[model samples]
Target: MGDVRAPVAGLPPVAALVLAAGGGRRLGGRPKALLAYRGRPLLEHAVAVVRGGGCAPVHVVLGAERERVAATAELAGCAVVANPDWASGLGSSLRAGLASLPPGCSAALVALVDTPGVTPAAVARLLAAHRAGAALAAACYGGGRGHPVLIGARYFGEAAAGARGDTGARALLAARAGELVLVECGDVAAPDDVDTPQDWARWSGQPGQPGWPGSLGQSG
Candidate 1:
């Protein structure tokens, strides 16, 4: 393993990867990116959370109704990537997002658009782990590991290679279980994601819930 030393200066450059291309099969063919949350698209909210957490050069992967999402959302500063095989599953979007990250990023912080409950605090905690010499880290809610996973640059290829079907980066994380640092974030964030109509209703029912929508992006 390469030296996982803490940066001598400020935190290393960590890029944000937002996977917002799901077609929302269970939600009646709606694009998850286009779904409204707190009067804004979930994509916008997800981007804001990561940005607020300090990740730079955000990259967004879009699938399903990519064009519609582009037109409907405010994605000004993020690099938008379109995945043609998004119908395959979440892994495609993950691979695309990772591949889209620019050079010089020491790591990639991956966020899912449907996971509205994940807050900027949770993202910051994971980043703190990265800066503290952890090469792999994830948010832990109630002892269960969850999203906005932080993947060191060294593992990007392995992560993208193993991201298949709906597994996303599960294979890589599982394979590196011993190295994975689980940062407890239950006190700061929720892991709920909008998958079905019931899930959508539950998410939409609460508009201004604390930590639900951090500073939103114009086009996250």
Candidate 2:
């Protein structure tokens, strides 16, 4: 692995890592990457969410139906990481994504495909936290830590090592809880993730309804 580059003058570049490899067992084995939010695949929306938040060179980790998703999703400029052990759990995908990141990235702002409620503004908040010298940070909803956690490059190895089963970075976060910065984002975004048919219906409300993912644009 190449050495992680240090920030030159301003905020270091933060890459967005989208974990879209989950096979939605609760949704009848549907691949979460292909889940529809608006008219585009959820993965596309996820990429857009990160891009809009100012994260450059997005990396998307694909597991379930990798080929189909690669062919169908609009991932023009994003790096795709194949997770063959996706069936193992979210941790596998998280590890794969982190491993695929280039050395130029100072940090990775990890996001999930099923989180349609997470907006660019919320992502920007996490990026800001990283810019403010936080090595680890997470968005807080109602004072509870939530998705789109930002992990500094220095902790990538520990994070990948601790990633197992469906825990993702939970173990690492818990181990270094004191170092984690929580940025309140409940006002800008919802942390609810789609896991079941009911969740799908709830998040995929009518086009014009409030909190609709498509209201702002084709992105999530």
Candidate 3:
């Protein structure tokens, strides 16, 4: 297995694809990127996570209220791409993000903004797990696999082709399971996401309510 390890060194630059383009159909049309969290926009946190996870030249996909998000959110140092077809599904955003990588980028660490439970530690583990130059790696919580998937440059075309609808690289991961590397991150982070109103309430700091301060998976 080529001594699978964390914190791959002397490797080509790894760019981050932070998929923040969701229209938030489940949240009554509110854009997930603009959602309030930790005194800043959710997209800001996602970008910080990507940068903190040891990736460079982070690319963010914006949709729905793209203009508002661009204007209000602190997206400095990130390459923002607007996905007009964002409503089509997560696949389109994934494709757009992948296509926007800077020249010479060898791999893309894909992450979702909705998954507030994911932390930079999980990302570091997945980055460390990349075996060959162009290998597949993903994070796992307990027994189930979760987001922030790693797609080597060699598989970018195939991964982008399979990226349709809400299934972002899952089809590829399922078919290439034999070649995939699963990094167990259950101890360092949570893989759950803030998808529903109940989740929002749980994270919301209300009187007499046990709020999840930094519970959306902040770096410890």
Best by lDDT: 2
lDDT of 2: 0.84
Q: lDDT tens string, model 2, 87-184?
A: 99999999999999888788999999989888888888888778878989999999999998999999999999999999999999999999999999
Given candidate 1, what's the lDDT at residue 215? 22
Please write out the lDDT profile of model 1 over residues 107-207, one tens digit for every residue. Answer: 99999998988888888888888888999999999999999899999999999999999999999999999999999999989998876766766777634
Which scores higher on lDDT, 1 or 3?
1
Better of 2 and 3 by TM-score: 2
Per residue, candidate 3 scores C-alpha lDDT tens digits across 1-220 of 0122233466677889999887776565678787777767888888877777778779999988899889888998799998999989889999999999988777899999888777887777777676443378888888788877999888899899999998989888988998888889899878878766566655544222333323223322
Question: Using alpha carbons, what is the TM-score of model 2?
Answer: 0.88
Give residue 172's lDDT in candidate 3 (0 to 100).
86
**Which regions of candidate 1 fall more than 4 Å away from where they truly are?**
1-10, 206-220
* lDDT of candidates 1 onward, in order: 0.83, 0.84, 0.79
Clashing pairs in 3: 116-216
Clash pairs, model 1 backbone: 21-63, 74-218, 74-219, 75-219
Clash number by candidate, in order: 4, 0, 1
